[model samples]
Target: MIRALVLALCGLATAATAQDTAEAALRAVQQLEAASISLQEAGSGRDRISALTETVQAYEAGMAAMRDGLRRAAIRERTLTRDLNTQSDEVAQLLGVLQRMGQAPTPLLLLHPSGPTGTARSGMMLADVTPGLQAKVDVLRAQLEEVAILRQLQGDALATLEQGLAGAQEARTALSEAVSDRTDLPRRFSDDPVKTALLLASTETLAAFASSLAEIEAETGAPPAPDATALKGQLALPVDGTVLRGFGDADAAGIERPGIVIATAPRALVTAPAAATIRYSGPLLDYGNVLILEPAQDVLWVLAGLAQVFGEIGQVLPEGAPVGLMGGDLSDAQAILTESRQGAASTRPESLYLEVRDGQGAVDPATWFAYD
Candidate 1:
């Protein structure tokens, strides 16, 4: 009886934990479904871009939740299976005892070797023990049901995960197209190709190149730079990522730079941190695709290492507008699930380099961006 009670309690606890995780996964799936609907119903052009962005974000979040829940369910299933296997003999003995007591004739069941007083005492003992045994049986039944449900949930979740992956991919494609087709954003000035080429050829380093941006002649009647003094220290990060290297932090080679490196997920979206005019947007030297934004006079925000860049040079972008996407191919649902099952760390592997320039030199980006 004591063993039965212990088994029952352990099984109940396991079931409860698994149920909570399963419910969370279900909620994530519901969120993904809603996001998908929003994307499908979105209007064309700029509106579609916003909807698609939300859909991709939703899919990413849902996939993360599903991965965690499935991992927990798998662990719980293994634990319950091992426990049941090791305690099989004890469980069988318990069942046999109950069965024999139920099958015994009434006369034999009432007749005790020590006569009427012993029989009455025996009946009282049976009354107390019966309820406990019944409770253990009930718990065991519930545990079995929970295991079955978990198995079914895992089996069904794979299809939903695959759908989410496909939806995210489609949304990303649509967003890229919408951004390309967009022509409504206001331009601060037109880029001077001849002057920019000369400046790039003469500069030896990023610092030198940034310091020479003022030499690039803007189109006539260009608007003055936006005032960003009030926005200092309140700007959002351009991408969702963790800081891999702080401003002035040395890397593996013991070389340091005046910028921070952010670790991000593959193909993650990058957005403008604040309303800014694009001073430059394209590949520059060995920095891969680079984007330089001027939000205020003498202040430049340099972003590098992107797979793609959006918006034309000299165009003014509103805060949170899509800038580009990080490099690397997006992992499929199966690959992500397999990694999660193995208890791998974060999937964020791409890096974005950010440098802030104020006046004639670089400044620590932490002073202007609220990453923490």
Candidate 2:
């Protein structure tokens, strides 16, 4: 009986081993399915990035149009001012008559009329005068007599128009700068030119690493990723922060420089602002810490300065994900770039620098962001 019990226990162990093998196989199949899904997501991201680019271009164009409109509007504003002034004088004279009627029955001007002709003027002519004349005048005259109001209305409208035009122009100016800087951003901000060269060299080395797990799905006839055609070039605020500074030279925290600027909280989370992946992340001399991202196959996204680099080369990320934290360690140039990159802020800043390059030449960031 003891011998038989031992044999029975050995048989049960064999059965358990078979069950574990089956479970492993099942889990692997599930992971393969998940990888296919990830591939599809990647395709969607690529399309989204494309759309984002187009949207940015459109926004820039819109801002350019607004700048022109404001110029014309500014001229028209003068006309409104002059008209308002003439109307105001008429209203003031009318109010004087009403004020006199308060103390006593004011004589009607026509009834008490003393003309050069010396014609007798009756009280019926006066009937057209006095406080009772409110029916004929008050509201219209109040509206008319208000030269200040008319001038103010023109002033207010002009102020609003100017504010919008300024923002639009600012965005346009920054994007234009970026276009010019596209070819040399790395070398411009590198610790040394050699380091910038090394960064570019490393980028090519990553091409061999693109063997995404989508290959298995390709073999299995699963669908490819969806293309997001609608999202291209959509203009959106890169961050939700207040405008710290804007394009042009301005001083803050005792720093000085050229280019558009932005001031954000140090250590605040930075994001791609569009779907993208790590193109380059490492030390660039003046950038302190740097990340180069590719939002589209043809376009690059650059962010410099960080407390830590959280992503690897070729890893994908969503728009506005935490690219890095501000370590209170950006070069003045990088700060300027940040402000310039967000050119729609109030008050031009000289402390920070910003630039953008579209293809070969400079375009305005304000126009890009504002157009859409």
Candidate 3:
């Protein structure tokens, strides 16, 4: 009986040892998984930090560039003003001389009731000045043309400076918001990976791509944005500049398009005219990068001629939020293309083409946008 009791105690001891070993192994595995999860989180955090750093650097560089551009524009403006004033005085004097000559023609002067001596004297004076006067008149004409061109250039420069300053301010605000957030927002809509790949590969043209994108978006509806119809004629403009072309204005090709073209500063920021949801944001043919915003169920706003675009399809944007930036002066290739198509070259670097469309057809945006 003593031997049996000892054997039973030994068996219990073995069982306890086995249970402790199992528990220890399970804990080891759990610890490894936890460490792996922590490593993954660390990696993601680092990547986000890097991205934010890049964004901040870019904003700073943009601000510096805008300041330099403004300074240069101001100097040019002053010089043009001085030159124009000088040219204006010269032109006025030339005009007065021409007016006097016209009033007293040689024939009328020769018939002066004074005498032959008076006629000879007048003829001699006219002869002496005629050659030099004609030359001066030609010079004045050229100077006047130059002055007009300079005035136009100065106007454009001032406009560009204004737009650049506004864009820089907006960029700073956006950067501040991004820095405050630890996580970055997704840049675009998250579609099924396989379907998106297939659709992208199959698309042959911009139109086809747009159609496919529409179908995909229909399958996954977008979040609602604020309606903008009620704010018509009260909404602010997307950029700072003058309207280069009004809605329905005829192009060089004699085609009256349904959109307005705003001539803005080079690399100027384009903003949302009103609260809206992005429908599409990317390059589309000759339009360059474009952003399509849906301000209401039936209303769509299309902004084209962007050098770079921000945000993504299906993203909600508040009024005055930056959407993209206007392109710089045309490249050599672009210049060639423009000349070939229009038979003329343009000096304007950036032009934002804005089109508003409803369920029926294209609509004028001027009525919806504030001039100021």
> lDDT values of the candidates?
0.76, 0.39, 0.57
Q: How many clashes in each candidate?
A: 0, 47, 0
Report the lDDT of model 3 for residue 320: 58
Predicted structure 2, TM vs. truth: 0.32
lDDT of 1 by residue, 126-214 (tens): 99998998898887787677778666655555555676667667767877888899887778778778877887888789988888885
- TM-score for candidate 1, residues paired by index: 0.80
Each model's TM-score, in the order given?
0.80, 0.32, 0.46
Candidate 2 lDDT: 0.39
Candidate 3 clashing pairs?
Answer: none
Cα lDDT of model 3 by residue, 1-372, tens digit: 112212222222232233443333334334334433443455554343333333322332333332333233334445555676877877788789789867986677576567888888878988999899889777656655554543343333334334434433454455344434533332235535576567656867544554455444432453444688899888877876678789899988887768898887565656677778777776665677878877876677888888877676666666656576676742332233233233232244578888877664678887788773
Most accurate candidate by lDDT:
1
Q: Give the poorly placed runs of model 3, Cα more than 4 Å off.
A: 1-223, 329-348
Candidate No. with top TM-score: 1
